[model samples]
Structures are given as structure tokens and as C-alpha cells.
Target: MILEIAQLQVKPEQSADFEAAFAQAQRIIAAMPGYLGHELQRCVEQAGHYMLLVRWRTLDDHQVGFRQSAQYQEWRALLHHFYDPFPTVLHYEQVAL
Candidate 1:
């Protein structure tokens, strides 16, 4: 499985809208073929920061299947605008027991 971790720093005033948008976005990603599951959490210390964790059967499932879908365009339009300076998305392969 491929695990994705994204740290997004949203504009202070846009936090609520960002969450709403992300919820809608999650629906799109969740319906894809290789999706496992995902979660989004707000940082307690900093209200405008969020953590997006997602699991996929393969990296190509995300990079090609989901990201290229039309649903993603709408998702990007809604949530990407709320980013303060853009998020950093990293992929990982689990190595822990």
C-alpha cells in the first residue's frame, strides 16, 4: 500500500470553509478504485493547520487514476484556494510492525 501524508496550512479565516471543501473532496477520492481509506485532522495547537492521511493500493492509483479524474478538478478548485502557501504531499511505504 501507498500512504500519503499532506500538511496543509490554510488561511486563518478560511479554516471552516477548507474543512467543508475537504469533506466534499474526500468523497471523490474515496470512490476511486484503489482507495483504501483516509482521514483529515486539524492541528490542536494551530487551528489553521491540517493533516491529510490517505491510503491507496498503489502509487499509480493516486497519481494517475484519482488525480486525473474530473472530480479532482472540482476538488482542487474548492480546497486548493484555501492553502496559505501550498501543502507538501509525501508518500511512504510502511516499514513498522
Candidate 2:
């Protein structure tokens, strides 16, 4: 599986609104092809910071399958505006322990 992590910096005053929007946005992503699951975590020390972790069957499942779909536009419309400088997204794979 591919783990997608997003570092989100929301506008200070709009954290509550951002969370609300994400509640709706999550449904959209969850319905996408190859979607495994996800988590949204708020920072303890930084009130306006959030970490979004998503699991996909493959990296292309996110980078192409979801991001390229029309649903992504809806996702962007719902949650994009809440960001300040915008979020940074990265992908990872499990390593043997």
C-alpha cells in the first residue's frame, strides 16, 4: 500500500470551518478507486496545522486516479480555500521491520 501524507496549514481563524469542510470532503476521497482508508490529525502545539494520512493501493491511485478525477475538483472546492499557503502532500511505502 501507498501512504499519502499531507501537511496542511489552515488559516488561523478558519480552523473550525476547515475541519467542517474536511468532514464533507473525506467522503469524496473515500469513494475513489483504490482508496484504502485515511485519518485527519490536528496538531497539539499548532492549532492551525493538520496532518492528513491516506492509504491507497498504489501511488498512482492517488497521483493519477484520484487527483485526476472530477471528484478531485469537488474535493478542492470544498477544502482548498481553507488552506493558507496550501498543503504539501507526499507518498510512502512500508519498510520491513
**Candidate 1: regions farther than 4 A off:** none
What is the model-wide C-alpha lDDT for candidate 2? 0.95
Q: CA shift at 50, candidate 1, in angstroms?
A: 0.3
TM-score between candidate 1 and the true structure? 0.94
For each candidate, the alpha-carbon lDDT, in order, equals 0.90, 0.95
lDDT, candidate 1, 1-97, per-residue tens = 9998999999989898888788778888889889999999899999799999999999999899888989778778878889988999999999997
- The clash numbers for all candidates, in the given order, read 0, 0
Candidate 2 TM-score, true structure as reference: 0.97
